[model samples]
Target: MPAPIPTKVHYHKQARELELGYADGQSYRLAIEYLRVFSPSAEVRGHGKGQETLQVGKKFVGLKDITPTGRYALKLHFDDGHDSGLFSWDYLKWLIDNREANWAEYLERLEAAGASREPLGIEIRQL
Candidate 1:
């Protein structure tokens, strides 16, 4: 089945949150920091599933720029010198819907592995 179309997008600079609204009368929220840290770029996501790199100390990160890639994706340039990810529309929607669950899981994994987003740079906060 085809994906639902998005009707609107809102970026709140003060809240550092992005809100997405769909034609199906659903809305999703995604934090700027979360999006930056989870960028799908190889530099951040790594070569494979287990090879992912951690991002750290990016509470203040923002979208410096965004370039649309066709009709289905966007190339984001984060303020923290990361510009490699091509965020597909579907991925963005998924992140918004699963933000809480995904973040909680990532936190658990970080604790288990003694990984710090600030230190190890994937799952912990330094600032």
Candidate 2:
């Protein structure tokens, strides 16, 4: 069976959710943070297995832009200056279907690494 084509895509800034409607009568609402942490970029996925990087401190990340990528994927521009991930239809569907399990794994990794979902802060002083 062919993958379902997206009929509509809506980005809700207030909720930080990306809602997608598909031709197969299915829809999904994915959070921006989820998308950020599970990005398909080399920075996140890395060059091969066992090299995935843990993305932290993105609890409040927002979408800056979403651009189509040659009809097969989307280039997501994030407010935190991350714009490398290419989200394909299959990947998007997987995210939606496995959101619960994926989130659990992410949390576990964060806890194990003593990391956090809250963005870090930097203090600067005047010279």
Candidate 3:
């Protein structure tokens, strides 16, 4: 089967989500933070398998912009200064299909690494 092609893409600033509409009538709303952590760049995915880096302290990270990379992918510019990942159409579809599982795995990894999603110096102090 051929991969689904995106028919429309919209970034909702207030919701901090990238809404994608595909040719197969499927749509997905991906969070900015999710895109940041799961970036397909070498900085995040690393040089090879088992070399994946854990991204931390990006709970509030936002998208600066998203530019198309030819007809195959998108280059996302992040507010936190990460701008290397090329988000392809197939990869985007995969992300939408596996969002729940991927998010759970990310949470598990974060917990194992003793990392917090919250940005640095921002503490949730209880009164």
lDDT scores of the candidates, listed in order: 0.76, 0.89, 0.89
Candidate 1 residues 18-112, lDDT tens each? Answer: 77788878888788888987888999888898898766666677676777788887787776778889888888877877888988877776677
Give the poorly placed runs of model 3, Cα more than 4 Å off: 122-127
RMSD score of candidate 2 (Å):
4.0
lDDT of 3 by residue, 1-127 (tens): 5456688989988788999987778788999999999999999999999999999998878787889999989899988889999999888878888999999999999999999898898544322
Clashes of 3: 0
Q: List the residue pairs that clash in candidate 2.
A: none
> What TM-score does candidate 3 reach?
0.91
Q: Write the per-residue lDDT of candidate 2 for residues 13-90, one digit (tens) a residue.
A: 989999999877778889999999999999999999999999999988889899988777888898888999999988
Model 2, 54: alpha-carbon shift in Å? 0.5
What global local distance difference test value does model 1 have?
0.76
Off by over 4 Å in 1: 112-127
Model 2: residues >4 Å from true position, as ranges?
122-127
What ranking of all candidate models by lDDT puts the best one first? 2, 3, 1
lDDT of 2 at 75: 87
TM-score of 2: 0.91
Candidate 1 TM-score to native? 0.79
